[model samples]
Target: MIAEGVKAPAFSLPDASGRMISLSDCIGQKVLVIFYPGDDTPVCTAQLCDYRNNVLEFTRRGIAVLGISGDSVESHRLFAEKHELPFTLLSDSDKRVAKAFDALGFLGMSQRAYVLVDETGVVLLAYSDFLPVTYQPMKDLLARIDAAS
Candidate 1:
């Protein structure tokens, strides 16, 4: 996994709308990058929905949330629409971004992971959970954001 305090690897990927989004575009804001295995799966859906439900809190703090997975743009669109997710879901179909973040596991799927990066592109937090049902909770992410500030 990428370590805290390191510069985050830059990436440009397609969002649900098929528009390209680059990490550089968020250079002046805190970014929460979530790397999950797939879309529409039970745990992935629940985790993203939880983030969606708390999006306001993140917005209030000037933080941007992004979800990345190996799924295609079409799949991302369907999943985001179904869940009503307010944040961007980027398609990493080649798993290149996942590899950059060291999120890919032995199974060739991204292990559930998160990288909280500050405005300058420095990583503030790096966490991953191998088990599908478990994830880094929103409250913990909030606490880390507060601490980072």
Candidate 2:
């Protein structure tokens, strides 16, 4: 995983609508970038829904949530629409972005991980779990972001 306090690598990946979104575009807001394994899977679904449920709180704090996976944009679109996820779901079909963040595992799948990036693009927290069924709790993630701020 990328270390906290290191500069986040720049990236521009396609969103569900096929529009490119770059880290630089989020320079003025705290960003929570989540790298998950795939779309429609049980653990991944639950993890994303957790974030979706708390999206209002994140927005209130000016934090932007982004979900990245190797899934295609179409899959992302369907998943986001089905779950009513308000965040941007970026398509990393080639795993380039995941590899850059060190979230890609030996199986060529992204580990369940997240990086909390400050407004200035410095990583505030970097966390990942190799176990697909395990994910960091939403409250814990929020606390870290709060402490960082």
Candidate 3:
């Protein structure tokens, strides 16, 4: 995992709509980068849906949530639309971003991970859950972000 207090690696990936979103674009705000194994899968779906449901909490705190996976933009579009995900669903088709964040697992699978980057792109928190079923809660994440600030 990337270490806190270190500058995050720069990245640019496609979103569900195929628009390019770069880490630089969120430079002035806190961003929660969520890395998951795949789209529409059981645990991944649940994890994203939970975030979707509480997205307002994140937005209220001026935080942006971005979900990344190896899935294609088409798959990301379908999944986000089906689940009504309010946040951006980024497509890291090559798994480059996942590898950069140390969120890549065996066989090139994306692991469940979360990286919190502050306004200046310094990592505030970096966590990876090897157990696919486990996910960090929004409340806890918010608390950590608040405390980090």
Candidate 4:
């Protein structure tokens, strides 16, 4: 996983709507970028569902989440609609964005993790691992945001 306090490279990955969303689009706001191995998988589902369940908290803290994977936009559309996810899911079909973030093409897919970036694109917190199925890091980030707010 990439270390904290480093600059997160900018990206313009396509969303389910085929719209390009870049890291700069989230300027002046904190962004939570969660990278998962794949969509419609067991652990990935739990990871996304947990974030989906905590969308309110994320919003109340003035943060936004973007889930990225190698899946196509159509796949992400189905998953997001089916699960009612509150955040945008970015499609990195070519794995370019994931590779730029050093979160993809490992183990034949993107690895599961989260990167919390400040308005300046500096990573405040980063987590990389597929075994953990909890949202502790997300919670921790919320706590920091709450304390700062």
Best lDDT goes to which candidate? 2
What lDDT tens digits, residue by residue, belong to model 1 across residues 84-112?
A: 99999999999999999999988999889
Model 1 ranges off by over 4 Å: none
How many angstroms is residue 95 displaced in model 2 relative to the true structure, after the best TM-score fit?
Answer: 0.6
lDDT of 3 at 143: 82
Residues 20-136, model 3: lDDT tens digits = 999999999999999999999988988888888888889888999999999999999999999999999999989999989888988798889889899999999888875878877
All candidates' lDDT scores?
A: 0.91, 0.91, 0.90, 0.80
Superposition TM-score, candidate 2 onto the true structure: 0.95
State residue 135's C-alpha deviation in candidate 4, in Å: 6.5
User: How many angstroms is residue 93 displaced in model 3 relative to the true structure, after the best TM-score fit?
Assistant: 1.1
What are the candidates' C-alpha RMSDs?
1.1, 1.1, 1.2, 2.5
Task: Give candidate 2 misplaced runs (Cα > 4 Å).
Answer: none
Candidates' TM-scores?
0.95, 0.95, 0.95, 0.86
What's the C-alpha lDDT at position 120 in model 2? 94
Residues 51-73, model 4: lDDT tens digits: 77778888876788999999999
Regions more than 4 Å wrong, model 4 = 130-149
What's the C-alpha lDDT at position 97 in model 3?
94
lDDT of 2 by residue, 1-149 (tens): 99999999999999999999999999988999999999999989988898889888799899999999999999999999999988999999999999999999889999999898999999998988758787767897788778877
